[model samples]
Target: MAGAAELFVWWVLAVVLQVFLTGPLSWLEWTVAAGAAVPAAFGARAVRRASGAGSGGGARALHAVLVWPVALVADTGRLASLTLRALRGRQVRGRFQTLELGRGTGAAWACTLLSATPGAYAVGLGRGRFVLVHTLPGPPGVLADALTDGRRS
Candidate 1:
């Protein structure tokens, strides 16, 4: 029952966001939001009831939407430079490197950082323990060493 209510709430929220973000809202949009809201609110209430705590869904959703722009911009710059060097045929060396990563979300973040940066690609991940990366112009051993060193510090 609680699960059903949460699902309903999610549906309503989705409709509301869609309308709010992409309006001039028509009557149809408002109607949809209204129809979805009941289920959504009910589901949200159920989820809260079952969990014995208030849901952080709203905060988490907002955070997820707002947190990526800076990272994306930084990554784009790195990729552009790396791509230009590759196009110039500048002695590009590519090799695989395995990095030890911190557990859980930390490892995921590290992988994202590596893949987002230019000249490096995360090819594989292993259970939040290690990541296999392919880096151009060789291993960037010095850069890798610096990063690993920083992690230690």
Candidate 2:
């Protein structure tokens, strides 16, 4: 089954990560990783199914993993610069804006990405097509730019 295959992949990944992090896995560690991987994989599968996201979910998830950290770092630096500028008596403005995301899963993904970054907070969802976000007076359209570009670049 697809779930079994997914679990096996996760199990292998866990084992590999354990080896990389702790430098070689004991039998007990292997057992623990195997046990943990099964439940985690199942939970992940459930979430993916519940989200009803389309077929490219894996690619999107991978892309997010690869680019999110870079974006987070960039956004944090930008936020700090803006904060310092504000402290120097420059005007800083924040606004609550609604964006049309066009799909439920897309909106959810966008919201999640926005909230995880430093300068943005995804506050609400509306009618399965819009997301409300607050940007903390940095460059506008961080979320919009990320979504449109399909990467944090």
lDDT of 2 by residue, 6-92 (tens): 657556655665665687777998888778777766665566568763323455445554676677778788888888998999997
Residue pairs that clash (backbone atoms under 3 angstroms), model 2? none
Q: lDDT per residue, candidate 1, 28-136, as tens digits?
A: 8778777866765666565546634433334433343344444445446655776788799865456677765432223333444456556557787654356688875
Give Cα distance to truth, residue 104, candidate 1, Å: 3.8
- Candidate 2 RMSD to the correct structure: 5.7
- Where does candidate 1 clash, by residue pair? 5-43, 6-43, 8-39, 8-40, 9-40, 93-137, 93-138
What are the candidates' C-alpha RMSDs?
9.6, 5.7
RMSD of 1: 9.6
